[model samples]
Target chain A: MADFSLFSRRFDVKRVPGFASVALGVFVMLYMPVILLVVYSFNKGTNLAFWEGFSLRWYVQAYHNEAVQEAAFRSLYLALIAATLATTAATMAALATTRTKKFRGQMLIYTLINQPLMVPEIVTAVALLIFFAMIKVATGHTGMIYLIVAHTAFCIPFAYLPIRARLESMDLTLETAAADLYASPWMTFRRVTLPLMWPGIVAGLMLAFVVSLDDVVITEFVKSAGQETLPTFMLGQLRRVVTPEVNAISTVLMAVSVIFVAMFFVLTGRKN
Target chain B: MIEIRNITKVFGAGEHAVTALQEINVNIAENEFFTLLGPSGCGKTTLLRLIAGFEHPSTGSMLLAGEDISLLPPNKRPVNTVFQNYALFPHMTVAGNIAFGLEMLGRPKAEVAETVDRMLRLVRMEELKNRQTSEISGGQQQRVALARALAPQPKVLLLDEPLSALDLKLRKEMQIELKRLQSETGITFVFVTHDQEEALTMSDRIAVMNAGRIHQIGSPRQIYDHPENRFVANFIGDSNFLNAKLGNIKDDQAELEFAAGRKVTVPLHRADLSDGEVSVLIRPEHVSIAEPTGNSHELTGVIENIVYFGTDTHYHLKLASGEAFMARLQNNPSEAEKRAAGDKVAVLMDAKAIQILRD
Candidate 1:
């Protein structure tokens, strides 16, 4: 038999009850809803709150729904285009801020790039809606372009932060040495700066993709008629009725977000 | 060859401005191993950077091989630099780093490879050619930096305290290695360092600077034996300064009077010795301790302490007027018991060994 005294000295049982209860409460509060939704998506019962038995009927229904399929494809397409555009703009902004000497209005430019993160999303959505409406009235055009523009604007800060941090932490002596070794300014950037900052760029792109993919409010406000992204489509379906098919669609979106975040971690984790 | 004329570098504007270099002028000869030696913040590295084209002089022109290249950027100038930190690209292998300069010059692929192999052999780093920069040791990194800088065949090379980060033994080894490389390549080298020993060991000529001003420029022997001012004398080696007054000036010598009515005749290197007040400088090794030898110019002092360094010993003495001075003596076994603390000894000074410094 193990000695009770040694075990008591090594392990503190007095605080276990309080700590364990707090942890359990947090876990249930955070993950319980998602876990319940996923479990009920397999329920044979049509009622979302009650499970009759295990089955894949909701999953099959979600796959066969033409409206859900179209919405998912649209969301993916918007995310890809917006993420690329945002990352490209963010790279230029990061380089301008970090690579050059401090100049007048530097602080103002930094604040402008990060304004979306500080201001409420609802305000941005309403503002973009009014601005796009005016443009449509002036030009008589309506398409997915308005939604893409709004999402890309919102994602710029997410991409800018990581790229700026990477550039700041880089050793400037390497670049100077490259110039001393007969490399032109453009060649130095192409050969030295790009290779070292690639990981940060990839991480930023992935973060923007995930953020744009999960957006709902901005999409709902900026998107024109008949341009319902997956989240907006899910919201519409929920208002009309409650079904496990909605849970199935949400599970797929969550999985894609998880994969993107994982890729970001792996890309930025390597030793330079 | 490089010529820097009337160079001044001010760091900032208005109240925050700082003068890093002021009206500096230097002419480094072709294939010369010259050095800019000073303490930190003395603008030695700034002067080197100006020559390397990394910085433009505020009010000066830099001529390279008789061509005005002051406005040319570093990439367009025929110069290379070995940064103090080695600055090896961590993403590249040793061979890739050494090949970078040649490749930037648009050399053919086969020529780049051959030059890379030659550089690897030059630094004795052929075995580590495929290793990443982070995987190499500091000394090895230094070798890679040197090879990388030399591979492009630049007309001039600038080294900014490249050996300061190395260990003592390795630094000593690299000092000789650097001298050998300079001679082998016959490239003009403008080395910067704060270590007096390193400058004395490796440089063919050195310019001593202080407070953004150059005090003297000469060969190692001239700089060590005969410094122009108190700064250079104190900076290069150990010296004892005695406050004195000039008594009379001859054609090639001068009479000086120290405190306690001590007078001595010293040779002058310059014809104009008319200054009334002067400071007499003598190296510690030049002073000797002996008994009264009927020499009127000799001064008596009491030994306060004896510091025994393995090859030599320093005797700290207090003179009659309470001024402290030091004399260095060889620590031979036969002379081991010659002097001790509290002993009275006469300090001997040779007329040729004394330097009269102008204030």
Candidate 2:
């Protein structure tokens, strides 16, 4: 009884019974479907509700399917290019907003950068579709470039938020001291500002990569025919048939996102 | 040497404008340890910033070594500042921070390393050269800041209350250390501090400022001993201001009659005294408690309160005319001379020690 009491006191399990129940309910509501989908991805039978003997047939099918392979490659390539472009642009925006004194229209620029996160995703997708159609008409070029541009635009705000937060929290006295010590503005940024803000840059890049990797609506609207990313491909598969191959592909993508998020946390967590 | 001429700094414009500095003019000689001393918000820091080229004056020019540097930016100027909070680079090691300025100037790596080592030894942090700035103590970080600012050997070094963040003992230690460093390096140091004692102890000459204007500029003794006005007299040290009427104005001395009709002659430090109402200033240390000598120059007062400091004691006295004043005496008073509350004592003012000022 004493050991039980000590354990209860240490864990405080009895004090937050209502909180524990709500948390349990929320976890079940959020992750149970994902868990079920993952479990069905290993199912040997076609029925998603009832689990059959476990097998790796769907994984093998996902791996071997040429369309799946092509879509996966396209998504990976698009996410990589989009995340890089967004991270670079967001970094410049963060530095401009946080490092300098307030100028005219600074608040407007900040609001504009964050507009994509505020507006509905479908509205943004339609706007991008119209904008890219004009660009395509003018340039006569419509390939992965449209999808990359759309993804990059959507990912900018996601990248900007964390990078801006990091820049705001940074001690600006170091830069001033650098300037006082005969460093030009460019040298100070390269040596002091860049090194200190590296973690934020990496975290922003990973967040943008994860966000762009899972996007389906924007990719569907902006991408031309024969340019189906993995998410859009999965959406098409779900519309036509109910199969475990889509679940397998989703599980792989989810695993990749989880890995990137975990890496993001690790990179941003360490103190310099 | 830095020459400042009619510099004025204003923040904002029109109705919202605040005058941070007003027509400041001073010349700081080369290798001089000059201090800008004032209360907070008095624009001492603004003057220091103007000299450092961090701020440009609104109405005047600043010349450094006879070259007009009024429009030059801080990086282009031959000056560096030790910030109030030390502001050492959190990401760099002690040696790395000290070597930063030399490296910025594109010096040879071997010379940069040598200068870093020399600066580390100068601050007596040779063993902590490899330590990160955040890993060290406040005092250590302060030394690193000084070393980093001094590494490039700029013509002028600006210190913005660099010792204000340290503990009391460490502050005292650094006060002496800073004075030694200033003299040893022979660099023109323009230090800004609100601490009066620090200004007195560290600076060769002090510029006392108040309300965005420089009130007086003199040596420490001159500032303390012979302040020009009521503000300087009260700001630098403990002073007792007595209302008086000027009776006779002579070449070397003046006769001042107190409120109680008692008259005394005071040495004239300034030549602008007229024959009307005046203010007589005397330091608390100059007022001595003694028995009634039946002299008209002495003031009879009753002790109101006695504050016993370890080294000295302050006796708050109420004069016969109901005016209150303080007299500070060394603690080594004879037992017979020790007077408590309600004791009647004659306050003696040395003729030379009493200062006469205009209203």
* Predicted model with the maximum lDDT: 1
The per-candidate count of clashes, in order, stands at 0, 0
lDDT of 1 by residue, B1-359 (tens): 88888889989889999999988989999999999999999999989888888888888898999999989999998899999999999999999999999999999999999999998998889999999999999999999999999999999999999999999999989998998899989999999999998999888899999999888999999998878889999999998888888877878877888873478888888765695888878899997899866566668788999999989999999987688889999888887778789998888877878888765
Q: Which runs in model 2 stand beyond 4 Å of their true positions?
A: A1-17, A134-140, B293-297, B336-338
Candidate 2 residues A1-272, lDDT tens each?
24576556766655765988888899999999999999999999988788888999999999999999999999999999999999999999999999888899998999999988899999998998998899899999987878888889989998998899888878888888888898899999988999889889999999999999999888888889899999999989988988898889999999999999998898777775
True contacts kept of 1: 0.88
What is the TM-score of each candidate's chain B when compared with the real chain B? 0.97, 0.96
| Deviation of model 2 at B38, angstroms | 0.6
lDDT of 2 by residue, B139-178 (tens): 9999999999999999999999999899999999999999
**lDDT by residue for model 1 over A139-216, one digit each (tens)?**
999988898899999999999988888888789999999999889999999999998898889999999999999999
Residue pairs in candidate 1 whose N, alpha carbon or C atoms collide under 3 angstroms: none
Q: Which lDDT value does model 2 have at B288?
A: 82
RMSD from true fold, candidate 1 = 3.7
